[model samples]
Target: MSIRARLLSTIAGQLGNPHGTLGKGVAFMLNRSNHRAIAGAVEATGVTAGATVADIGFGGGAGLSLLLERVGANGSVHGFEISPDMLSRARSRFAGEIGTGRLQLAEGPMTGLPLADNALDAAITVNTMYFVPNLDAACTELVRIVRTGGSLVVGIGDPDAMAKMPFTAYGFTLRPVAEVIAALERAGCTVDHQQLANPPIPHHLLVARPA
Candidate 1:
């Protein structure tokens, strides 16, 4: 691979599952850069007090933090991330909330979230779809984790815009928004699509619920 490819691969790997000292830095950047997607995705879920919600692929824990706050003292939040480093950071940062049973964290694969069927009042995932190896399982699992009237929010950058990034050349699957909506629909969801941001990223947020 060329030096550029090598760099792209390294960044791509870190983005997929952050780790070690360098990952610490990536985690910080993600928290700052992905705030809009994270916050909007959570809001799309309509999360409320006393409800149980989860932030899948919680990245730098920004989404997890938002969920924790929205769920409040009475509610609970479950966070699932594939990155051990990020999970450790979250565990440390939200120790008090975790100790009080207001937050739960898990490091695992996207295919299986370690959650019971219909366990969540709502769920949100931001910019993590491209890394999922199995789109079928990803779609199925998102719906499986949330109850029939419960909501799910998926956030991602437009495929055209994401294709502009070199890192996407390695291990990233640039899927069209329609393809994702179709997959979710097959899993029994009614998707509502809206552009969350344009130009630079062409970000989108898809809110869905069971038919």
Candidate 2:
């Protein structure tokens, strides 16, 4: 493979499941760059005390702590991560919350979240949609898990901006904003908000609610 192709492949591989030292380093950088977007997604969920929420791609757990705070003593937050390195780091960081039964972390695929159907009050995912093997299936899965009238917040960098990145040429799917909103609507969600920003990196935040 050409050097460029090889680099893209390596990035895609690490994102799919970061595992070792390199993965750890990448996770750290991801956590930093993704912090604001993650917070925005979680805020869009409008999570509250006594609410049951889930973080679909809870990488490095940047938003986990904030989610836990919003959930308070009466609520619960579940984190589903595909990366082992991320899962381990999250589990370690939130051990106290986990012990208190306020936070639960697991290694699971987004297409088949390990939770009861219609079990969540809200769900959020930041910078994860690009890596999903099937966007439609992933949307169906998320819609199935979130209860009726529940919120689903998905945060992503602007496709136009992300496309400027090299990995997108390899495996990342630069889904159009319109296409994503349509897919969520098809999955029975009513798009409530669509926020966009361009600085540092372009960002898009979509907030939807199940019908």
Candidate 3:
């Protein structure tokens, strides 16, 4: 690969599967940059105290804290992540909650969340869709994990806006907003769409429930 191509691949790989010190740095940046979108996703999940919720692909764990708070002390928050580095960071960062059994983090892909069917009251995944190789299978898994009458909030950067970024051309698989909604619908979920008011890069949140 060309030097520039290699560099862009490295950056995108870090975003997709953070590793080492540089990956940790990228995770920190993602935590900050994705803050607004994560907040909106957590809200859309409609989690209540004492409920069980999961943050699928909880990159940098920005949404994990929010989900924990939404579920409160009596509730449970589980996190599934593809990156072991990110999972280790969360294990250290949320040790108190882990010790108290209020938070759980596991290393796994979204397509195979290791949880039983209807294991969650609500679930949300923020800013992690582009790396997923199989959207249809991932959507099916999301439907399987969340209970009937429960909610699933998926947040992603706008494809048009993401396309404008030079680095995204490397490893990102930016999908159209409509294609994502259709994937969820095919997975047996009724979907709703919302756009956050973030500037520069628009963020889309898809709220889905079992139809």
Candidate 4:
């Protein structure tokens, strides 16, 4: 492969799941860049105290911490991450919460979340959909896990803008906003809210509830 192709492939791999030393570096970058989107996703969930929620692809645990705060001391937060490096970082960062039984981090993919049916009051995933191989299956899993009346929020960068990013030319599935909403609706979720964040590369947050 060309040097540029190889570089993009490496970056795509890291984004999918950070691994060793290099993975750690990539995880740090992702945590920094995804902050606003993560915050927007957590807020979009509208979770409250005592609510049980999960943060899908909780890179570096930053968003997980935010979700924990929103759910308060009485609630629980579950983190789903496929990347070993990211998962390790999250476990270390939230050690206190794990020890106290308020948080659990599981290593797994979104297609088959290691959670029970109707087990969550809400769920949120930020900037992770582009990496999922089967978007429909992932959406179905979300519907299966979140109970009726429960909410789900997914955040992603605008595809048009993201497409302009050089790295996205490699192995990225930049779905249109309408397609995403349609997939969620077909999965039995009712689209409830939508928002676009501030700035040049505005992020999109879509909130839905089980139909």
Candidate 5:
């Protein structure tokens, strides 16, 4: 990793949590317009209370925490992150929820989540798809884990915006949102909603359902 990536990795490992830590940075990076657009798409899909949700590439755990709050005590949320450092912070931050068995954090990539097929009610990934080496495999894995009626929410900032960001100064290429949507559709996920917002940053929110 470059110096910048190493620094970000360190920071993410140290401060990220299940609440709003990493998300604050994400929100700031995306600016207000894109943030609202992504939020609107999520709300439209209806995560609902008591749903079994999984947040893939759950960076500081902000989205997962939000889902937790929405799902309430009767619901469950599972978070998956490949970064061991990030996973540690998330575990510490959500200790109470984990202890209560309402939230579970796994240290792994979304492509190989240790979950049963058709077990989740919903799942979401925000601005993390760019780092995935195999988008097709990742989408397949997502489809396998989500139930027939379950939803997959994906949000990605514009590649141009990301390239101009400090993180990309190190070495990160933004993934094409159009290609991602096409891949998801090829995997048999029905596209339920799609939205694009350009403000803080250009972003696209695509909500898909398992067929």
Candidate 6:
């Protein structure tokens, strides 16, 4: 395998197999300040205790689990992952929730969500926008699935920080935050909140409401 594939495999393995020997360490590391910042950004989008939610690119299922906790049993959480390996890992990690019907793991891109229009209360994506080749289409899909007044929160590494990272080696492009926000606005979403957080990594969070 190539170096990029190997690196991603290592990261995914560490995250997906939380019951594996490395799972505890990975979980612990995720609960630290940096991950907390990402989680907080998602929460700031206004997900409530009984809101149906979707977490796009739910790597290792960490953010999905966090969202589930916020929404509790009254709500349902759906996780969309394009990576087969990552989805497998997430399924294993949240087996209980999946089995009980509280969480749904869908294997596909957010561009073609298997959901009805205005079906969700909130949706969040973290550190995954860089992989989307078409920002406008993705934003439209996000807004289409969420109800009016629903929230769509997207978190991505700051372009400047991503430009300096090793992510380029893994095929990640550093997309400008302004471009993302503009695309969302053009797609008919009202800009509700935008902020940058500097922690484990420098990232930008954009929250919008369906118009």
Task: Give the better candidate number (3 or 5) by TM-score.
Answer: 3
Deviating ranges (above 4 Å) for candidate 6: 1-34
Q: Write the per-residue lDDT of candidate 1 for residues 119-170, one digit (tens) a residue.
A: 9999998889999878889989889999999999999999988898888999
TM-score to native of every candidate shown: 0.97, 0.94, 0.97, 0.95, 0.79, 0.83
lDDT of model 3, residue 187: 97
Writing each residue's lDDT as its tens digit, candidate 2 over 143-177 gives 99999989999887898898898777777888998
**C-alpha RMSD by candidate, in order:** 1.2, 1.5, 1.0, 1.3, 4.7, 3.9
- Write candidate 5's Cα lDDT for 1-211 as tens digits: 7777798765443322322365456434433334454455456557888989887776655666677887899999999887665677678889999999999999777788999999898888776676676889988988889898778888777777777766454334467777888888987898754656564566677888888
Against the correct fold, how does model 5 do in TM-score? Answer: 0.79
Rank list by TM-score: 3, 1, 4, 2, 6, 5
For each candidate, the alpha-carbon lDDT, in order, equals 0.89, 0.85, 0.91, 0.86, 0.72, 0.76
How far off is residue 154 in model 6, in Å? 0.5
The Cα RMSD of model 1 versus the native structure comes to 1.2
Give the better candidate number (4 or 6) by TM-score: 4
List candidate 4 segments past 4 Å from native. none
Deviating ranges (above 4 Å) for candidate 3: none
- By the lDDT metric, which is better: model 3 or model 4? 3
Better of 3 and 6 by TM-score: 3
Which 10 successive residues of model 3 have the least lDDT summed?
196-205
Clashes of 2: 0
- Candidate 3's residue-wise lDDT over 133-175, tens digit each? 9999999999999999999999999999899887899889999
Q: What TM-score does candidate 1 reach?
A: 0.97
Better of 2 and 5 by TM-score: 2
- lDDT of candidate model 1 versus the reference: 0.89
